[model samples]
Target: MLSIQNLHKTYGAQVLFDGASLQMTPGERLGLVGRNGHGKSTLFRLVLGEEDADSGIISLPRNYRIGHLAQHLHFTQPTVLEEACLGLPEGEEWDHYKAERILFGLGFVEEDMAKAPSTFSGGFQIRLNLAKVLVSNPNLLLLDEPTNYLDILSIRWITKFLRAWKNELIIISHDWEFMDSVTTHTAAIHRHKIIKLSGGTEKLYAQIAQDEEIHEKTRVNEEKKRKQVEVFISRFRAKASKASSVQSRVKQLEKMGEKEKLSRIANLDFAFHYAPIPAKRLMEVHNLSFHFDPHKPLIHNFNFTIHAGDRIAVIGKNGYGKSTLLNLMAGELNPLHGTVRSHPDLELGYFGQTNIDRLHKGQTVEQEIASANGALNRTAVRTLCGIMMFSGDNAEKKVGVLSGGERSRVLLGKILAAPANLLFLDEPTNHLDMQSIESLVEAIEDFEGAVVIVTHSEMILRAVATRLVLFQHGNAEVFNGGYDYFLEKVGWEEEGKQHR
Candidate 1:
């Protein structure tokens, strides 16, 4: 077993862990979940010896091999295959096929394996690192957001691969479905305490919520008893005949200690503001085609129509033009050979993955959301800001100084401020936490408008996709069914290959 005992860590005023202890049983694939800044990554660093805890014991067996995916970019070999094989043990160095399987499952092709690692993009380099970690036969595998750079196909393949893990594993991901699919146990970091539970993440979170509720109820009952004692003492204080009784009551009230109230944790909880339209046809794509290279078009002769209350999910590999399809329909990219027409009364709210970068550097969170102030009054704007987790002074923080996740929230705030009949969201769940993603999913499902979302998460797709725009085998086609139908009748093209 891996034991962490009496762990206590603090950074200035922020308490990350306090006397927290947890144990990992053998063969347990634990999914670690916590809100942002709750030290999910910090715990990984502590186990890896990359960071020191303030004071604690993280006891692992001596000579235990711990494997983790590297973010560093340093290549020592000429070919991608050679660099990945460096992770193999001394006698297993000849097991190149294992490395090949992992690399292929992670989206690497046979032709690409011969090329230098430096020749690939940053995302591909990260995948190469992931392949190395997977190839290494370690006692414990610690993966943090392994699906971040992967496509839907690769994510699917990895879920299968991880299910076959024989040893212990710990993974951190915002996609609960992905985590829950592979994990045998769930552990969470709540209120600077480690909570480990069997089964999926939902069980752990539900337990935590129940515990907090019980704590609050107990506190309330204790307060009521204390108040009753005080009243009795006040009513008999000046009466000499009841002097001893009042003194005893005062002592009883003193012994009834107060229960500390749990601090409020801000969560992303806001619905999208919908501007309903009477028109049934919101958008039309007539033979749309777009290409940066005339000889090799990314999108060619694609056709789809958008109707009110339609939930269209665009899905494909990384460079397969899923985002391009959204951009073409959204007027961010002009079609080369066709047209995309929208109803004039349609109110469009776009939350692109890259659009967060377009947020004005000098503008505060309040200013950015307030830019769409025509739809919301001053008090509503403040309330919206608070719901986006930017209460009071945080709303005034400049966009230039905010992190990627914070900027994503600001964009959501802006979307909430604007009343729109149509929404075009491209990977909006990238930097959000698990709870935040659930809230966004609820908001999307509740909106009375057409939603065109570009996503790789099957969880979101299964929950909301009424129709699908598929990029399969280098062709874009419309599948007039739900995601489950696509999985049952026609699956991803990559699933046909035997990478295992």
Candidate 2:
């Protein structure tokens, strides 16, 4: 069990939290949700004693075991197994058993245990980090974005593992479905305050919204009553016989008035226009095969056809060829064997997860859009930027000084400003807030073009995907359904059974 009381933290001028409090008991699973850069991570740091809070008290039971997943990790070992073993406590028997169990759960085979972790891709390294944490088997676990780079199968594994776990857990993740499946309680951070909810994230959010609606209605009713009483007093106060009663009614009205200035919910509206239809066939792939190493083909015998106005979603686990497939479609890579053909007049707009580093350091947001070959006039560009929540002086600030979300918005703005009939997006919702993501969903829905998106976000898939393509074992299999249908056909319930 652990408790955080009267917690307060601030960064320079910005107050992250004030008087925030929370209590956790054994076997409790809590999901922490908030917009990006709102101190969710900072709260974890405060709990772990990795950072000092401005003022607060964090208390845990004596001898309580704690485990946390580090955002950035450095492994000095030569192999994945070695890195995972490093987290094991001393004693040969316990270390060997835990190491083996963790490696197996994380999808590593006996042969892979000997392979250098550095040789693996970043996603694999993240898996290694998770394996390390699992091997420790602490009583309290703090996971931040644990599903970010995991493939569907691995994510399923994690969800199962957590559901079976008896220890207390506080997880922070952007994946809505994952949170709903694993967590029993919700903690939301809003406007420098923390709200604790008794139900899961989705239910809690719904209840909060409902409560706000009820509160607004009550406030309105109270205001109406006050206005009626005021009118009565104004009309009857001049009469000698009714003066005392009118004055008494006015005093009661003043005492019973409601506070009407509750904060309004933030909402965004977005629309996008696509150019006239170009060609029937937007892109074609023939016998496409690629491999980082000769022995292991990431994608092989992949062939597909994309047409105008088609919204295709690529689904797969980590290391499976989702990004590679998008890159091939974008003409960023040559297939090791086979031809990728694009129709003439098929202009493309590509957004990748790693595009944060692609922005020019010296260019301001406005300057970056202006330099894009006159595709958009100043007003149109500014309006697009504003829809992304960048306005006034923020648009004039240098891109280098912008936060991660701001940079993402700038990049997205530039991409939207371009004229393209086909768009290839890789995890485009990574750094976006919920509001911005909804705005993007609206824009994409209105665009008259073909879209190929690779993401693990269930919400994004539900909003945009019309066709599902599953990537497994170096092959692509097409399924004729939307996101929900794909989940049903894939036997998500059966996968949940595997967890038990």
Candidate 3:
């Protein structure tokens, strides 16, 4: 459907691509992979003609219709239904039906259809944007982080939808599982070029690992040969018997040194500092019920207790009281009808979207960590900052100038540094890349204290959660068989109805 050849793009001194080429055809779902700020979006812009490549050609069919999801939705329509129905064809009945079908599949109810789009949360508004794009039914789809704020149920629905989509697609996402389940081809941006591989995202990761292993072996062999040559040169360069051989060896060493190039690897050693597990139950909740409006209760008759060594995942659809429950537990929200009791020795570290606001704008990353825990020395704070991908000079940058994702990392770093036996995290993986998420999972697995996390990431949930807290119909249900059992018993079964 589209072709890119010799795509050269640069921003001043930084070169994003050099002769990168890729081709897309019908029935190919392409997953574009690259580090942040590495020109994946630049390639998209080149394809969309939003930015001119330094020098290259991006060829597209004449009058090809492309449906691209916007990073933000700008709604002028009065109602959510009206915004979703923006691009439908002439048939009024079928148009409305199709719009509603897409919206409902994405977790919007009939009641929500009549509400103003402005009233919906940012996540819900993004779903509306997705609905608009789907209703357009274009020839090619360009989705950038389409599952950014989606719940697990909505993510499953979108995955199933894209899995069955017949046309061409190119998606950029940090969700590896989502890409693996939906895409047929993997396109990786590496070494200033695009490497297209058969199969999915997992195959791309395997290929990268294999290539790194091969590169390591080659480097080792080359280094061994260079050392032997250097030793021979050093031992015989003074003697006339081996002078000519020594000169040749010197030239060979220079050539080897010039040709050597190390494989690029991301910094993935992120680890959360551990805390001592408390001897007592971390927290206890009894008959917890909360509601923003008196007429409709979001949480009703909820009771749960969190103990030391507990790794719990809170999950549900949007507006189903998952976040509210977390807030209630964290004491951010007062319960309408119950008590949240905590052990006197329980030290808590809470991480949520709003935690970013708690960070002092004047503070640097290292300073933030030190301020969080007075016991941590300068070296320890710097080490923690480096583990969070802020090393040396980057660690000295002020929090005010950092990106949203960077600020999120800073808050997480603070939470990790805090001497907290009980941790509360809501959507902690939302802003993290796959590598960072993997590191986070490892850290969570290694944590000795109690953790209560609200996330849609199956990887994190399966790896870190020993129990599942599910929100359903204004009540909470506890599942003791972990995340896999939750998927088997409740996750897939409930969302699969829309697919059928």
lDDT of each: 0.90, 0.79, 0.83
Q: Per-prediction TM-score, please?
A: 0.96, 0.85, 0.90
In candidate 3, the residue pairs with backbone N, CA or C atoms under 3 Å apart (3 or more residues apart, or in different chains) clash, namely: none
> In candidate 2, what residue range of length 10 has the lowest lDDT sum?
264-273
Tens digit per residue, CA lDDT, model 2, 253-274? 8799576657754444555446
The positional error of residue 76 in candidate 3, measured at the CA in angstroms, is 3.5
lDDT of 3 by residue, 1-500 (tens): 79999988889898999999999987889999887667887888888888999888898889788888877679999998888898564455356888998898888988998999989888888889999888887778898888876888788778988999898899998888878889999998887889889897778878987987788788888878988998999899899988899999999988886335665555556555556654768788999889998886888877888988899999887777888888888888999898999888888888877777879999888899788889888998898898777888999999999877788789888886876787788888776766777777777787778889998877677778889888865568788878888767666545566458
Order of models, best TM-score first:
1, 3, 2
Judged by lDDT, which candidate is best?
1
Off by over 4 Å in 2: 76-78, 89-95, 218-260, 264-269, 442-446, 458-464, 476-500
What TM-score should be assigned to candidate 1?
0.96
Show the lowest summed lDDT stretch of 10 residues, model 3: 258-267
Q: How big is the positional error of residue 331 in model 1, measured in Å on the Cα after superposition?
A: 1.4
TM-score of candidate 2 to 2 decimals? 0.85
